[model samples]
Each structure stands twice: as C-alpha cells, then as structure tokens.
Target: MDTQTLKHLNEAQREALEVAEASRETEWTSPSFVAELFMGKIRTNLIFPYPEQSPEDRQIGDEFMKQLESFLKCNLDPDEVDRTGILPPEIIEGLTRLGCWGMKIPKEYGGLGLSQINYNRAIALVASYCGSTAVWLSAHQSIGVPQPLKLFGTAEQKKKYFPKFAQGAISAFALTEPDVGSDPAKMTCVAVPSADRKTWTINGTKLWCTNGLIADVLVVMAQTPSKIVHGKEKKQITAFIVEKGTPGIQYPHRCDFMGIRAIQNGVIEFKNVVVPAENILWGEGLGLKLALITLNTGRLTLPAACGGMSKQALRISRLWGKEREQWGAPIAQHEAGAVKLSHMAANVFAMEAMTYYASALVDRGGSDIRLEAAMAKLFCSEAAWKIIDDLVQLRGGRGFETASSLRQRGEKGYAVERMMRDSRINRIIEGTTEIQHLFIAREALDYHMKLVGAFINSQSSFSEKWKSFWKCAFFYPKWYLGLWCSFDWMKSYAGYRPLSSEIRFVGKNSKKLSRTIFHLLLKFGPKLESHQMVLARVVEIGTELFAMACSCSKAISLIRNNPSDLSPVELAKIFCKQSQIRIQHYYDALKKNTDPEDRTLSKKVMNQAFSWMEQGIIPDDGAGFQKNSETTVPLEEKRRYSV
Candidate 1:
C-alpha cells in the first residue's frame, strides 16, 4: 500500500500492517507452486507425479498407526474426557511410552525422527478418535519449544532441550496476550536486557497458552529494546526458552472453552522472569519471523487432523444414512440426503489429496510452501467443518444428542454433536479464517509489489518513479496480453487422461484469476486491501483452482497403480465439478456486489441506528460476563512489563 492510503487507516491497522510487513519473508528463494499460480503460471511438473510416500516410510507410519489405533481403542473414552474436562494421567503416560512425545524430534537427539508425512499420519489417526487427545500431542510440538528450538536454536540449545521431549517433557507457545489477538505488533509482553547483557527479564500475561498449565518448558515471545536504523526506529520481538521451575512464572487459572474440553490451556503470568541470554532461540529482532516460519510448517498438522475428523464424519453419515429411513425410504435414497452423501465422500477424497501432497512437499524439502500450506489450512478446515455440519443434519435429532445420552437410551452413539463442537476451533486456531484470507492476499500481491512498487509507491523519488513507470510500461502490455490469449501446446497434462477436463479448467482459469487480480489492482490502487470482500472472492477462486488441480493429480497417481479400480478418479470428477460451480459463483460476485451499500449500512449499524431494531429481544448488557482479574493489570504496571 502507498503512504497516502495508509494515512486513511486507523492507528491499530497501520501498526499491525507495519509490523507484519517488516517481518515478511520478502525473498522467494525457492519456487512455490501456488505462488506461481497467482503469477499466471502453472508448473504441472510439481504436482503431476503427486509425490508418494516411499515404501519404507509408508511401512513405518503404518506400523506406528496400527499401534496407536490399538491404544486409543483400548484406553480412550472421549465422552468421559469431555464430561470431566481433564485428560487422564495414565493416557499421557501411555502416549509417552509409545514415543509420541518425541515424534517430531530428530533421531540424533535420541527421538523418533518421524518424517512430516509420518507425523501427519499419526496425528490424523489420533484425531479420528479424540479431538482433545490430538490437541494434547500436537500442541506439545507443532508450535511449541521443540519446533522453534529445532528450526532456530543453536546446536547447544537443541542438545539441551531435544532429549527432554523424548523423556516426556511438555511444552507451550506463548505469544497471544489478552489485548493482542492476531497482531503481535500490539504485544506488550517485554523482555529487558541486563546491564551486562548476560540475562533478560520478561514480564507479561499470556492468555490461551495451550498446554501452559502443565508444560515443562515454554517458548515465550516478548518485545525487546528497539534500534534506530536509516533514520527510523524498528521494533524487536525475541523468543526465549523458559523452564518449568522458573521462579516468577505462574498459572493462576485455567480456561474453559466451548470444546476440546480436556486441553490444559490457561493464563501464564511472567513477573520479572529472568533467563540467560543463551536462551534466545534465534536473535533479538527475529522472533516474529521465527514464529511465522515455524507455523508455516506446523499448520500442516491441523489439516491432517481435520482430514481424520472428516473421515469419521463420513463413516457416521454413511451408517446413519442407510439405517435411518424417512418418507418411507432409506434417507440415503432421498435426493437431499443423497447429494450430501456423495459430496461428503468426494470432499474427503480431495481433502486427503491436498493435505498429503503438501505434507509430502515438506518432507521433500526446499520448496516454498507458504502459500500451499496456508491454502491447505484454509481449505481443509472450512471443508471439514461443512462436512461435519452435513453429518449433523443427516442424523437429525440424534446428531444434537450427547453420546452418553444416546447410550443411556440404549442407542449406539456416533458422537456427531461432539465432533461439531470440537471442529469449530480449527477455523480459529493457527490463524482465523479472516486472517488467513488477508495473509494469502498479501503474499499474492507481493510479486507485483516487487515488480512495480517503485512506480506506485508514494515514497519514491520522481526520478525513480519515472524510470519504474517506463519499465512497467514496457513490461506489462506483453505480459497482460498473454494472460488473455496465449496458449501452451506443450503444457498439456500427459498422464491425466481420466481427469483431463478438470486439469484443463485449472490450467485455463488460473490465468483468468491472475488477470482479474491485475484489473482489480488497477482499479483500486493502493486502497485495494480495504476492499476485503473483493479480495476474498479472488482468494476463494484461487483456492478452488488449487483443490481441483490436487484432486486431478492425485486421481492420476492412484489409478496408475490400481489399473482396475477407478474410484479415485470418479471422486476427483465429482469434487472438481463441485469446485467449478463454486469458482463461477465467486467470479459472478466479483463482477457485481453490494460493497458500497454494505459499507454505508455497516457504519450506520455500528453507530447504533439499529438499536431500535433490537427492541423486541431480551436486554443483555454483558455485565454477567466474568472478566479475569489477572489480565486487568494497571497501565502504570503494564509499562513495567514493557522494554
């Protein structure tokens, strides 16, 4: 965005964008499949083979999953855990005994050294049975100390902490505070350096720190002292490793949530908590980047877990669809129920294809998967939620009943209601759905930002602007013209005969999608980001295109080996047609929508013009809501928490 347009934003929006811009991975050192899609290019080679898990790796994961399935079947009672809001000690011990704690740690550290594919398989298996248990294991390593320590730690740091995870030590990530939800720029948590620079003192309250209540170690983010460079001051956020017995660390209360009832999430308070400088995982000014990088990979776990849950929903829906009759016939035979059932099956197939493909990319390494991972998280989470919602509707009243209640009435409980409650959190964690849209949009624009920023940036000198304007003038006409009419004869998907139509749609519409973004950018200029709905539509279109391509790629791979069963290809056809319908709807909305009217109405609504509209409803003022005293620290004291 240009400087003049930035001036139109409120202080909070400006600060958040500024901090996020500073920490962004500005260089695309490696090629990204999704990023290229935004650039009007499709590298079919990347997705064509649909990278498969090696035979040995598959055997290893299969053996581990078998053991995990036996353990969960024998010991886990998910309904009981949800009712009690506590995971049993014996279950945690059993997981540790099975080496779940060391699943992500490298074998050099005497840990499991599981590949990303294997780890995701294990997570998916666990999640199929219990949501709380999945969170318990994933939270310990996905975004926890082990992840950062392995990614950014010194050799000595890894040597010190890796062994602990293998020995059943739990860990947590502390970044979000009471006031700061998604933006770390507003973070008031501070770590102050000692006079000798040998120790750092941290003080702040971290809210919703998953696994914090019982974690043996923590990776805490805090603002350090700022530095002046090039006539500007830059904020510094640092990551630290704090141990369990740290004197000033306290968890005074645990948080109760709508779902995942057995999680050990709580408020963690740090008061003058001091640690040696060596505890810094990366460097003083690189904490936000570290967290973002860690999450780029950690986000994979959620989609796989979501796939697991989606599979379970499919199973329950299938059994109920046949067993329950309505209108004098099996529900599965009814038009509405039949449509949902077919789409549910098709969606599950695509969900597995997209997530497992991304996981395989991670295991393969050196591919820029930022866009791919974010899209996987966004697509799979939303798709899984929709699948579960359909399951509930299919089950009718039984879906809303608790499993225990159903069992008490002498009926077999499928746990649809519990799954719905548990699945809602996926859209909120890692990053919210709205936040992911913004993140994807920002990265999608980055390629153009680098190419033409000097031309459009208000901060640029007239001489520089003149050169950039002429550069774009010479470059874009040819580039923009190709997006409209260019045809690549050599770009035909060779091995994708069964699903060639879907592949062709993605290949063709990807260019149209990029062209649409170009026109929108031209129309809105630097103020385009403020037009969020328009950008969201563009993102959804691109996401659908990615899904269709993955589905086609995986279908080809599956049918090649079987040679007889083309069920996977048939699933791909259903999923791709579904995605095409969605894409067209998005395109239609992009051309015509009530955006201007919406802005005006939203302003009036927030200004209390609609207060009269709510006169019939019971009056509620939120006074009954309990505010935590621990987070309501005084302002003067909050400064004491800052650097």
Candidate 2:
C-alpha cells in the first residue's frame, strides 16, 4: 500500500491493523505502541523491518526495568523528598548500584554495557518520576568522564578508568564557562605545556558544570600551544582528565537554575591545575571532535527523558480534564478540552515514534544517526513543553500552585524552558537545523543526480511518483512566479494592520485572494535562498514530516505482526493522523508561493526531486516486524507481574 491509500483508512481500521501486529511483551502505555497505531497498516506494511537485536535483548531490558522500578518505587514518590534542591548522596549511590552510571562502559569493566536502546529505557524510567533525576543521572552518564574514555581514550586509559568509573564514581564535564557557549573555538582557557611535555598546567573557569560539587574526576578542555609544521607558532584546544583535588581545581557553590534544580550545576575554577601529559583525549586539536562525538551519543539518550515527560504531561491533562469540568460533563468531553488533549497526544506519540527510530538506528550501528538524534531531541523537547503547557492550562489556577506534582512547579516550567534552550543548542551543536537541511538537500540532490545520470546514461524511465514528478517540472515557472508576488504582498502588509479601523489594505484582499497568495507562497516561498533562515525552518518542518511518516509506517508494521502485543496502537493511530496533518500544513505552506519566479523554479526542482525520491526510495518488502529480543513489557506480562 502507498502513503495515500494508508491515509484513507478509518481510525478504527488503522487501530485494528496495528493491534494485530505487536509483540506479547510490549507495553500498552508505551509510546512505541502508540507509534505503531500512528503509522497504520499500509505504511507499516511498506516499511516492515529494520535489523538490530532479537527478542532476548528486549526481554533483558524489560526485566531490568521491572527490577529497577521496584527498587525506585519507594524512593520516587511519597513525601517532599528534599525539594530544597540538594543532590542527595543517597540517590547517587542508588543509581550507581543500579548500574546507571556504567551503562556505556564495557562489560569487562563491571558495567552493564547495555546498548543505546536499553540505556534510553533506563532514562525513560527515571524521567517518569522526575525529569530532574534523569538530568542528574545523565550528567554522570553522558558528559562526566566515561564518555571521553570510550570515544577518544587509549586502550590503557580504558583499562585504568572504565573499571572504577563503572562502579558509579562521580565525574564532571567542565566545558561551559561564564562567557562561552555554542562557540568553543573562542574559549580563553589555556593549558601551557611543561618543559618536557610530561606534565601540563591548566588554568580556566568552567561554569554550569553538573556534578562538579561531588565529582571524583573531571574532563577539562583548554588551549595548548603546538609547533605548527612549516609555521612559526600555533595553538590548539585540547581535553585532559583531571583527578579531583588536583592542585588548583576549585568548585564554587552550585549555581541555581530554573529547573532540574536537584541536579548539581556548579562553577569550577582551574587555578593553575596540573595533569599528566598522557591524559589528553586523542591528542591535542581532537578535543572538539571528541566533544562532538560525546554529544552525539548524549543526543541519542536525551529524547527518552522528553518522552517520559510528555507521557507524564498527558496523564496530568487527562486526570485534570476528567475531574475539573466547567459544564455538567467532564471537560475532556468538551470540544476545546478534547482538542487540547488530542494535540498533546499527537505531539507525544510522534516524538516517541521518532525517538524509537533514532535509538533503533543507533543500536544497528548506523554511524550518521546524528541528524536523526537532533530531530528526535528537537521534536520531543518541543512536544513535551507543549503538553506540559496545555496540562497547566487545563488545571487553570491550580496548576500554577506549587503544591501540584513537581511536573507543575514553576521550576518544572523552567525544566522545559531549559530543555527548549538546551534542545535548540543541540540543533546548532552537532549541526544547525540549517546545516542538517544542507546535509539532507545534498543527500537528496546526490540521489537525484545519480538517478538522472543512470537514466541519461542507460535511457531508462522510472515509474509512478518519479514519472509524475518529472512531468511537474514543466509547471515550475508558474509556481515560482506566484511565490515572488506573494512574498512582496506579505512584506507590504508587515507595516499595515487590520486591527485598526482606519487601516486600509489593497490588491484583492478577500478570502479567495488570501488563499491564492497563500497557496502560491506555500510551495515556492521556501525556495528563496536569500532567506536561508526561513528556508532552514521550512526544511526542518519538512524533515519532521518525512520522519514522522517513516516512524508511523514502522509502528504500524510492528503492531500488525503482533497485534496482541500492541493494544495501544489504537491510540497511536490518532497521533499518527495528527503528525500527518501537521506535516501537511508545512507542505501546504510551501506550496503557497505567490512569487512567480520562485513558483516557477520550485515547481521544476520539486518535481525533479520527487521523481528521484520515488525511483530511489526502497520500500520494506513486508517481512513483517521481526521478533527482536527487545525486553518489552507486553500488556499480559505487565498484568501478570502486577504486584
């Protein structure tokens, strides 16, 4: 089945199809289940299987979660557990014992050595109770110390560090400073080499260092002067492992934050600190590369926290909407409330599906999953924020009160605020959204170029979408011209307002004209390279749309193969519809370029690209969802395991 045919299915039919395909061990409450429903039958059937693990790994993951959940039950809820914002030592010790700190470490080092998929499952569990807790745990797992060892550390470094580090030894990632962010090349921190290159001295201040107050180890990046080959003088930034109490390392009291307050975020002043020469990560100048790789790894793990938060937000809204009614019936039964709930559901489901896909890709050893990770982080963070915002709205005044679950606290709002800020940072970190687009466009263009070359060289004609797209190229000029005019009109209206009674607008200002202009701008408007920022946004939306489509398809296939396993596919289908409509809006928006010039070119280029995508796009030859060894809690198992 094609995209359109699947789009035509009723919600009930889609749900039924998904229910028939899921495994018996997966959870109904999971975003994975919802993701399946979101994809439906046709798309799912088309994109059936991606290889990675067997059902055994999934089982291990589930069992681990169950054990961890039982351990966390008493600690997670009940009583106001130190909301005064101290990183409790007890919690740290508990996490260490659970192997949370050593997940990425090799199995030989006493770490669980779990894959990215299982690690994210652990993160989701932590996030469900407290996003703050997840943040604290992440500081140790992602940034602290173990990461550098895995990515850039020497074999000896791993042997010396991974064993002890895996035992929950706290560590700090000292990078951010008072004046530096986003741009590390501009950092002023310096590390001058000693006479023999045997020991190096460091001096710099690192601000916003999580776990700094109690960490036993530190990964510090600084500038080092290296002799340039054929050049007079040179300096490069490098990273080093600084043991705690290394002379000159000092920690200021932890900095307070808007959210995730329980996590320790502090300032570390490296006043003439000293470290061994052999401690450098992949030698000098590779610090940036090491940082980027570690971040990519962290990005894979970030989405699960957001997924958990989104789930929590949905639960909050549902409970409040049902109990707090304006009319005789529950507010959830009302149209306005229903719309809000639907939107929240859609966002969460889409985020979850995308996260799952990204994790799966990473687990399968796909190296270029950075863009996917970024997309997951961006979408999931935004979705969680929206859900929380709506949940707050649903509670009206009560949600604003500090007495609500930590999810509704003023700081909870900040957790989202920071999450958004942090999420945006990632968008620009590994690659900006603009950069991702450039990467995507380049990939798309390459694929198309190959197709055209094949056709030109072999005289072969592609079928369906490709042929139709090639045909649409002739209509480019008309579309491009329309976009230019629409933009001109929009620019003209910027200074004018309809809110004022005296304001006057010109050039056929009716609903029809508005739509005509909008339609034209939607397609060709995004073609303006001069407005690269806007173009970046347009592409970002497009990427989300495409990714959502793929995710929905994947989920649907999973559900179809194991219906009893994915009962929640019914809910997922609703969310899938939501993603489709949202994506369509962007597509429709791109279609409305009133500028004639852009309309012309965009039509031709878009058609050309469409043809290429179709010819090159390989559909999943329905092997159905392979029974992977993913440790999942199917509805029946959860029911049986219920204490």
Candidate 3:
C-alpha cells in the first residue's frame, strides 16, 4: 500500500498506486471531485460562487480585448488563410507585438503575466477571428515549451527561455509519436546518456507535433535507461529542451489536416541529438508528470477556443435565421430554427460559464483541477460542435459553400463549412472525447480504486488489510447514509441562500449524482473499470452537474452585482433545464440501458468476425484496405458515386 511495497507489484500496478497516492495528496488541498466523486461526495467549494477576476485585471483585460479586436480585424483573414493553409508573417508579427505568446509568462520574465481567465479570454477572442491563428498562438503557449518550462524548469532554464518566449519565439511540446497517441507509456522514443553523463543523445520521431516545423524551442519526451529503484529496474521518461537548430533535429515532412490548416504541424525526427545535462526538465522519470501537469491549465485553451467558436456560430446563426425567410416569415420565428438558436445561445453561455470558472480555479492557484479542466474541454468541444452544426443547418446551402465561393458568387461570405471542419479537431485534439471520459472515470474512481487496491493487495500485511477493510466499511455506510438522509453539509459552499430555483436544482442533483455513483460502486465493486459504458454515464452526469453549478453560480453572481439584469438568470435556467434532462437520461442509461449486447457486437465486429460483409469488394482486404489500380472505376462514375 505504501511506496516501499510498490516493488512487489508490476509496472502498471506500481504506476497506478503512485498516481492514486499523488492524487490523494493533491485532493487534501485542492479537494477536486476527481477522487471524492467515487466516495459519494461533492466538494462544492471547488465549483460554487464561481470565480471572479480583480478589478485591476478586468481593466487590463478590457484594454487588451480592444487592442486585440482592432488588430485581428485589421490583420487576419480567415478565408485567405484557410485557402493558403498558412498564417501571413505580418499577422504573426502583429500578434507577437501584441504580446500574445508571452501572456502567461511572468512580467519579470518580460511577459504580460495575465491571469488564466484573461489569457483564456484572449484565446477565445483570437479563435473567433481565425482558427489557424488561434492554433498558432495556443500551440506557442498552451502545451508548448513555454508552459512545461515555466512549470518544471529550473531557474536557469527559465532565465534562458523566458525572454525568447516573450519576444514571440514559437515553442512546441513534442510527446506524441506515430505509435503513441493517448498512452505515453508505450512511447518508443529513447534518450541515452553519454559515458561522461554530460549530455543525453535523443533519438525518436514525433508525429502530429503542433508547431514542430516552426518552433524555436521544443520540449521532447523520450525514454531513458531503466534505473534500479528499490531493487526494481523502472523505465525512465525524461523531458529535454531541444533548440530549433540542434544538429540532428529534422522536420522530415509537414502534416496537412482537415482543419486548423495554418498550424505549422508535422513530424519531427531526433537523431542522436545531444542535449546538455542541465536541459533535462525536473530530472529523470518525471516527463509524463510534467506533461500532464502542464496540460492541467493548457487544457483550458481548447474550451475557451470552443467557446469563441460557439459564440461565432451563434452570431452567424442568429443573422441567418433572422434574415433568411421561410414560407410566411423569417426562420427565427419557426420553432425548429428557434430551438437551434436558443440551444446555441444557451450552450455558449454554459461554455463561457464552465471555461471561465475553470480558468478562475487555475488563477486561484490551489485546486487540482484535472477533472474540471477535462470536463470543460470535453463539454465545450462537443457543445461547440453541435452549435456549429446547428449554424450550418440554419444557413442551409450557404453553409456548405466555401466562403470564397459565396463571395465570388455575390452572396454573403461566411465560413460555416470551415468552422465545422475546424471545430471537429477540438474534440480530437488535446484529448479525444472518449479519452477524456476514460480519464475522468479513472480520476473519479481513484479513491475507490486505492481502497480496493489496499484491501486486495497480496503484498499488504494482515494489519494493513484489516485497516483498509475497516476504513472502507465505515466510509461506505456513512457515505450512503449521508446521501440517503440528504445531508446539507455542502450548503456553505453554495453561499448566501434564498438561492435561485436553478441553483437549488443543481444543489439537489449533486446529491443524487453522488448517491447514484455510490450505488453503482456497490453493484460493481472492483470490476467497475470494465463497465466503461456505466463509467461514461457517470462522468457525463458529473459533467452536467458541474456545468449547472457553474452556470447557476455565475448567474447568481451577476444578479447579486447588477440586480436589474435578469438575462444571466434566465440563461442559467435554460441551461440547467437542459442539463437536468441530460442527467436523467444518463442516470436512466446507467440503471437500465447500458447496451451491453451492442458493445459485445461492436467488439466482435472490430475483431473481424464480420469480414465476410466485404467479401465481394476486395479479396483478403480488411478495413481501410483499398483496391489496386487494376480494379478501377471511370473517373466520372467515381465522381458520381464518391461520398
């Protein structure tokens, strides 16, 4: 159960235990629902009353936004960039002059030192103007070398890199490879120390590395030799800073994407690249930890960007809905269009609520927001996607047409199609939707996992087992009883009451969610991880609850400050109503509609049991298999039939 006993376990088991222990320690101060959710508790302090920026910061942000608006409007062209697949140098120069790259870096380091909320707001504004520009700026700071270096780099490292970052030098974080996507443990990149140990020779290929081609500095992760730790040889993953002109670093090929086309992304190859010993970030075996920790706040960029996308979609949809008429009146008057418009606006409000709330937590600088960040990214990305889709639906044929095509044809130029394409990547990048669900589930179940792990660990002594068993026994009963009895312990976190009905609804469901999780744990016990379908539902419910809490809290804050304006309150009600329905749907699915048979069938199909279905199409061909040139169709016919 302790670190010393970890040697008796396998690598995966040891890692899991270490992670759980680290998370437990983090929760003591941060008190995130990531661990507490499994224990049937809502740490309301983490989410309620929302977060607010200082007046000084707000004033700075206002000025920054005005400057940003003028700069973006005067400089960037979304349509031109989408066509050219590159951002103009002048625009990058302009952004650099505006200090976009150094927004998060400390002022002492020659950067603006904006709070997380303001930084996020900046990203949202930049993203609204151009997705390509957003990616360029975000990649430079969000997960780029600046972030990891700022978080884990030594004082000397900061001194060396901060000024360059502030001057708009592009930086990138290279961790992904052709074979490694979500699982960094499976990374094949290797870093071997020289005999003198003065330098490390890194050899690896990184794929889909954002800004890989254009970055001045790169934070690269590679496997070092396994070190003997307490009689066990543990593989070490270390992070190193490799400068742009490093002798053996090469950008072999640029990668083209379906969207965010202006990103200078590609494959980066490291061939015996020598990095000085001082370049290793946070020492050996901590690369993954650094990457994750860096991403904690870096993840906020996507949600903020998504919020901007949603806002833009809402704007365009509104215009199209009002100006475009149907049989008797404008489409805005039609129930179908009205529903999409309302949902789009409501979702944008919810996204802003969630994004800023999470950003505020980051700015507050104490909470372990791993769960909150993931939830915001997941929810906002998917919501933005839906909102953009709705925008397209509202725009009709014009939505599908290229902005340039529309312009040339003397129609309104709108990037609805481009926006849809760009928005799709938000769900896929940083972490996929499915990946986020699994991650949230893992963190949410950490407490339970640790308890069960302790009880069942064969390496544990009899005393430890009994201790764990007793703890679990007492905890479960009390937790269930507390839920069933409708404990009001979290009321303080909700703040001054005579709470809005929407806020009350969120508070009520938080308990219901906790109770549902408890029952689910009781039913599944240690085998709960295998029930991913159920876990996904649980995560979804928690996401909705958090979103509701955020929306209601923000509304309440607005109402308290401005008493006359009720728009925030109304919007919160709409969002909460939608979230309430979603929570019920997920709760119902958890109880009765898990679709196990469908899952089993899907697994079977994945394993190729249904290969015969494509028998006549191509012999011995599997999925993704294509026919040779000998089996060809006419160009016209291909054009006619191609999807």
Candidate 4:
C-alpha cells in the first residue's frame, strides 16, 4: 500500500494512487490526537483541554445565530422549498442582507470574518432547520471558491474574488465529471496554455456541480501539462478561478437528487473557455493539494451540520417518546424505547464534542486536524442518520408521513421522514463513509508505512530494504515491548471524577488497538491493505476510542463548570460504556470474522453467480437510461439558457 504500488496495479489504479499520494499533506507540523491513538499512544494532552472556543467568538456566533434562526423561522418555508425544488429568490435575498454570504470571508474584504467555530455554528443552525438552505450556503463557502481562495489564492486572486463573495456572489467547486467521482487522476478535463502563454483554454464538463446553475463564480480543477519527476511522468492538476459569464460556460442540464432538492445544482460544460494565467491558485501542479487541504479543513462543516441535525432529531424523539403511548404505557417507559432514547441523547452529546473540538482546532491553528475532522465527519454522519431513523420509528406511522401530509391528516408533523432523507447525504458527500474509512486507515498507518513499509515491500530496492529494515528493527521492537506495559499507574485522570475509569479505558484499549495493528501488519505483510474488513474494524475501534475520549473530556469540562448539574457526566458515562461494548466487539471480531467468506461471495456476485436469484423480479430492460447530454450544444441555444 505504499503510495504507488507498481507491483501489480494497472495503469489507471497506479496513476490514481500516485496522484492521491502526491496530494496528501505529508508534513507533521503538530500532534494529532486521533493519529497518535492509532499508533498506540493516547495523546491525552491534546484531548484533555477540550479546545474551548473563546467567549468573544462564542458571543459572535450566538448573536448571528439568533438573527439567522429568527429570519429562517419567519421567512423560510422548508416544506415549500422542498416541494417546488426551488429556494425562493426572496429567501436568498434575505440571507444576503443578513450577510450570510460573507460568514466565512474576512472583514478586511467586507465580510463577517467569523471564526471557524462560529461559521460551523451557523451551518449547524441552518442544517437543523433546512437541509436545502444549508447546502445553498455551505456549497457557496465550504468547498467553493471562497474556501480555496482563502487557503491558496494569490494576493491578486484574493483581491478580485473576496469582495465578490462579500457582495453575495455565489460560488462552486467543479472537480467531479460525469464519469469521475473520487478519482481525479483519470480526469479528462484539459487546460492548455496559449501560444503567448498568457492564458489557458479549458474544455471539459463538470457534473453534480452544486450551485452551478446560479453561481457567480467557480473554482474549476483541470489537468494541465505533465511534469517529469525522477524519470516518471507526473500528472499536474491546476485550480483556476473561472467567472460565470466566461464565454464558453454552459449549464447543459440540471441535476435532481433524492434529497436537498432545492439546491440549484447541475451539469456545467466548458468549451474552449479561456482564463488568464493569474487565476492559477497556489501555482501550477498544486490543484489537488489545494483541494485536499481545502477539504481537510472544509470537511469539518458536515460534521457540525450532522451534530445540529441530530440535536433536532433528539428534540423530536424526546417529545414523541413522552407523548406517544403503546404497550400499556408511554413509549419512553418501555425498555426498548428507553435504550434508544438514552443512546440518542448520548450520541448527540458525543457528536457535539467531536465536531466543536475539531472546529476549535481549526481556529486555534498549528494543529493537524486531518484525522480528527475525518473521524468526526465519518462518525457524526452515520450517528446522525441513526438518530433520525430512531426518531422516525419512535413516531411510528406519523414519522413516515411528510410534515405537510401529517398536518393535512390532523397530526403533529415534525418532518421526521424528511430529516431521514436529508441526513443520508452527509455520509455520501465530502467523502463517502467507505472512502473516509480508507482515508483514515491510510493516514493512521502513514507513520508505520514510512518507518518499515519498504522492508516488506517486494518492489523495494536493496538499499531501500536495508534502510527500512534498520528503521523497523529500531522502532517496532521497542514499540511492541512498551505496549504490554501499563502507563495508567503513572498517569491520573484527576478532574474526570465519575468517568475517570472510562478515560483510562481509552488509554488502555489504545494500546490494544496498536498491538492489533502491529500484528495485522505482520500477518498480512504488504497485502494488509487489501483486507478492507480488517482495516474497517480497526478504524471503527480507533474511532469509538476517540469518541470516548472526547465525550469524557467534554462532559468533565461541562460538569466542573456547572457543579450543580451532573447530567453531563451521566450522558458521557452512558456514551462511553456503550462505546466500550462496541469497541470490544470490533476488537473481538478482528480475530474472528467471516471476511474471507464475504470476499468469496462478493467475487461470485460480481461475476453474476446469483443472476438466477432475480427470476421473480420485474422484468424490464433499462430503456429509459441515458448518458448525460454532451457538451456540444449550439451557441444560440446555450446563450438562451440562464445562468
């Protein structure tokens, strides 16, 4: 699993792997809590303080959220937005007047200049109320031009774009093509420089471009000329600031999806679109790196978004649990209902701690939050969906009904079903859950791979092997020996009163996780990366362990400050105990699982071994299926289309 495994990878995979590895932020400028936990070291200091947002920043968020909440409640009708598949122009105008457009931009640029925490809080609030509205804003800032501009824009680039964003100009990031989702190496979009070398002519089509239908500007990623490095040809992806009215830009089609339907998303086609060389962000050959780093921090939004949505779900569930009656009593009193309610509360608490902690790290600066942010996104999205699902179940048939329908039928319509649909896309956007797991696994094992991977890799040169062998010999033995020794006796969880032992459990099991990883590395050697199930289990254990630490730290911090209330401690304790059970189950499954059988069955299924099982199903061919319309529309027709 080294960056480019040349041994057996085909051209496409090898290139994809190489491009992705090249894009990774390879420096370790600061300690990462999740990164160390995977290495068998619980960097307690990183998580212990809990990274609180400053009072000044919190106040800013509070005031803005107050205004936003009020405006949304009074003016925005989410059900209508969903039903029409259109966010009203008046609602957008209201948001603009509130300066929602500039929430992430700088004050120097005529923007709000809210801290990361505050920006996240705004997103969370928006998401809690309206998923479509949240995307409308988040897409414009999160991975859109404003984000990359803030991160990698040149001074000139910033001067031109920042004010536009401040003036309520919407923006989008265009990276996905019709055939490409996560794999950018296979990207066919090309930007070729002109004879004068002053501008580049780009030709490509971008798919699923959120806000593309109405965005004022876009950050488009396209492959530039290749560069030869160390006797190998390397792909170079360059980011450019492409204005909406650029001559050849076309909105060929609009995209409708299962959720977030009000978002003005669609397919964007570029035909010989020319742009000045000054638009190149962070220089040529750094577009993917820019995207990755932008996403590294930008990805924090969804986690906060998930946390907020889950909070709403919790509220809806609690009311239903108390009011809904069945089985001779209120549902909340039933054993099964009680467990679900408690877990929902606990999980929501953990989600808050996880999301804010990561956002706080972004605001604090000098902290490596790549792992933390991804874990938060991975955990919160999945957790929020479950929370919303449980809300639906608790509401029984009422949950499945649309809020409008419920109102029509004379029932309380809380939008439980809508929430479920909205909650699902979080797991898929930013990155899919499976991709996040693999991304985390790759990063979690980065240190190990750097230290000893060459020693076991068949493709390593003799000298490389010699170097890595020495590195391995000097590192793993001492690391392995230390794992068996308990460091708990030397450390004390002083402020963690009722949950001190749970905090210690995180420390202890971290060692076990590290040992398990080391053993897996030994058993599978270079092929361990192929063992997706094993790595998934290992990642899950590490994630829950991380969750336990965050929950404990946050709960202790809360209870200490509010000594009169111990409910925070109670919630943390419940979450940690449940996390403990899950962690141990994953730990046990590592040694005993049906992964081999699962893989066997998967291959057979892919080979259509079970085609006969489809005999009883509806028997129609996919007659309606069609590829996206091509990018060759005539100029007259294209010009008639509105942006």
Which number leads on lDDT? 1
Clashing pairs in 1: none
Tell me the deviation in Å of residue 12 in model 3.
8.7
lDDT, candidates in the order shown: 0.90, 0.60, 0.83, 0.89
Where's the lowest-lDDT run of ten residues in candidate 1?
1-10
- Least accurate 10 contiguous residues by lDDT in model 4: 1-10
lDDT for each residue of candidate 2 in 1-643, tens digit (9 for 90 to 100):
1112233446544333222211011222312211222111112222234233468878878888887788777666312332567545676687778887787788988998887788888888777666567776777777768877887789988888898878877777777777666445456788988999898899888888877877888788887875564453334668898888888878766787656666677888889888999989888766655665576667766678878776877887787788776869888888988999988876776676677766776666523554456567666665666777677667666655554354564433323333332223233433444544543332322222322333232223466446545644554445435434544333343222211111111121221222332343344332322344444444454445444444444555556567676633544556645654664565465556444676577898877855665576656778975666576668798899889
TM-scores vs. true structure, each candidate: 0.96, 0.67, 0.91, 0.95
- Residue range 271-304, candidate 1, lDDT tens digits: 9999999999899989999989999999999999
Full-model lDDT, candidate 1: 0.90
Q: Using alpha carbons, what is the TM-score of model 1?
A: 0.96
Question: Which prediction has more favorable TM-score, 1 or 2?
Answer: 1
Candidate number with the higher TM-score (1 or 3)? 1
Please say which candidate is ahead in lDDT: 2 or 4: 4
Q: Which ten residues in a row have the lowest lDDT in candidate 2?
A: 497-506
Candidate 3 per-residue C-alpha lDDT over 76-167 given as tens digits, one digit per residue, 9 for 90 to 100: 88888998998999998998899988998899999999888889999999888799889888888999988888788899999999999999
Instruction: Let me know the TM-score candidate 2 reaches against the reference structure.
Output: 0.67
Residue-by-residue lDDT tens digits, candidate 4, 1-643:
4654445567787778889899998878898999989888888889887788888888999999999999999999988888899899999999989999999999999899999999999999999999999998998999999999998888888899899889899999899998779888888888999999899999999998899889998889999999999888999999988998999999989988888889888899999999999988898989999988999888999989998899998888788899988878999899888888998999999999998988898998988999999999999999998888888888888888899999998988798778888788998889898888888998988888888768767778999999988888898788889999766668887666778899888889889899999899889865777787889899999899998899999988887788899998899999998999998899889988999999999899999999999799867787775545685677789889957
lDDT of 4 at 522: 81
Error of 4 at 277 (Å): 0.7
Candidate 3 stretches with Cα past 4 Å from truth are: 1-27, 33-38, 42-48, 487-499, 615-643
Give Cα distance to truth, residue 515, candidate 3, Å. 2.6
Q: Which stretches of candidate 4 lie over 4 Å from their true place?
A: 4-6, 625-643
